[model samples]
Target: MDVDFGGADDILFERSGHAGIVTLNRPAALNAVNHRMVRALTRALAAWEADAAVRLVVIRAEGRAFSAGGDILDIYEAGRAGDPPFDFFADEYRLNAAIARFPKPYVALINGIVMGGGVGVSFHGSHRVMTGNAVFAMPEVGIGFFPDVGGSHFLSRLPGGFGLYLALTGNRIRHGDACAFGLATHSVPADDLPALLRRLCETGDADASLAVDARAVAAETEDAVMDAIARHFAHDTLDGVLGSLAADGGEWANAMHATLMARSPTSLRVTFRQIRTGATLTMDDCMRMEFRILSRMLVGHDFYEGIRAAIIDKKSTPHWRPAALDAVAQADVDAYFAPPAGGDLSLQ
Candidate 1:
């Protein structure tokens, strides 16, 4: 049975059997999330939660990329026009928190790129089903942004300081690595996703249906690099991490140093503190913290500058303010964690 729910054309909301389905339909834009898409998803999830007919929820995308990220171009345009678009972040963060606390089995069928906001909706769910082609990352630092969308919570919890390394470096990981790190719950082939979705919808039994096509991901011996990450990134300050890397003077260390140098110095410091603080907070608290960071980021100099260099100008040469990491004052970094004029996110 199909339920007719009105939403933006880029996103489809329907019900089939015991499952409520959300299909991201904007393939050309790579399913980039917008304010309308976020609102519709939040509404659909709320309605499904209250409806006895829908026992489970499945979120999947129609494009090659699950979702590259939020509609950053929109944000950039608004910021340039003197309107910071805090509404979008509020709604998106609320949606992330809702997914985290969703009562039913929330399954995300990921077969392509999943990063930034895409990770928010899917990773917080009870079931994160990924295919061989699926890639995961939180590349916000490159754009002078901290990894929001509940990244503070999830990233802080990943074992062995892998989360901080990913945050600072903006690295992408394949399905195998994601599964090994517990970021992905199940591994299914891309070709079998449709069948698996059908089984989930028909039966509303995630464990049983997933077991049919899913396999435990074997830990790669190469993942022993987590030990190195823990050693380099476990420091209390960004300078400490940089100092450790500089002292090593090795190939990998030098590469990481160069990568950090290319990113916004402010973003690197903010993300470092965000991850550490989130380790002590709850999911909802983490969202609130991210909201604070977002308020500051939208009004700051680097985010728009980063957008100009990377997206608008395509130059990939962002001249970040206070270009050096040492110039990012600890007080300025603390300001990002402070409450905004609108107050913190009220997740009730």
Candidate 2:
């Protein structure tokens, strides 16, 4: 059986065999999730959850990228026009929570670029399948945003301080690294993906269809790197982390120090707090925390400035307000975690 709920065509939903299938369509947009796509996906997942015929759900995307993230251009325009799109974030956050709480097996087939919003959708699911070509990153700090979309939950939980390292640096990682870090449950070759999909659809058994393909040499090397990451990022404060990196006097340390220096100062500090606080909270609480941050970020100066430089103008040189980490006040960072006037995100 197959089902199609038509709308903007940015996403497609269908039922195949025992698996409910979701294909991120809008390849030209790199499957960047917009408000419409979020609502559609939420509705589809809800419907499938109640349908006994649908034993599991499989999410994949068109084109070379799984998803680059959310539709920041839409967000940018809306915010610039003075109407912050709060509903979008609310609905999206609810969807993220719903996915996290979903009873059925949720399999995400990630073969290409997966970043901020992309991470929100796939990483929350039960099965995160990465192909050889997969590339993953958080990258939100670079855009003057913290890693939202339950990043506070999952990123905080990644072992050996790797999640904190990823949040601050926003570095793109490949299959080997993702596997080494436990971000990916299964690593499949591109050529084998089709067969894997077929088997999944036929059997609806995620564990049975999946096979671990992490390279021993790569995992061995990554273990060493994780040790370095754990050491440098072990500090409670951003300043302490930077000091650790500086004292090392190594090439990698120098590059990491420079990368952190380039990110928006406000974003860096807020993310540090977000990751730290998230470690102690539940997934739902983490989503609420991200909502609080989003409320502040959408109204702040740096997010727009970041969009202008990185996306609109392509200059890649955002002049962030407060410019340096020391200039970002503790009080201001504290405000981001506070509840919004409208209210906190109420998840169903």
lDDT of 1 by residue, 144-247 (tens): 88899999998888887788998999998888878887889999999999899899989999999998999767655375466778899988888899999889
- The TM-score obtained by model 1 is 0.97
Candidate 2 TM-score, true structure as reference? 0.96
- Best model number under lDDT: 1
RMSD of candidates 1 onward, in order: 1.3, 1.7
For 1-348, candidate 2 gives per-residue lDDT tens digits of: 656655368888877778999999989999899888898889888899999988899999999999999999999999999999999999999999999999999999998999888888898999888887889999999889889999899989888888999999998888777777788877777777778778878888888777533233155345666778999999989999999999999888899999999999999999999999999999999999999999999999999998899999996799999898889999999999999998888998
Off by over 4 Å in 1: 1-5, 219-221
Each model's TM-score? 0.97, 0.96
Instruction: Tell me the lDDT of candidate 2.
Output: 0.89
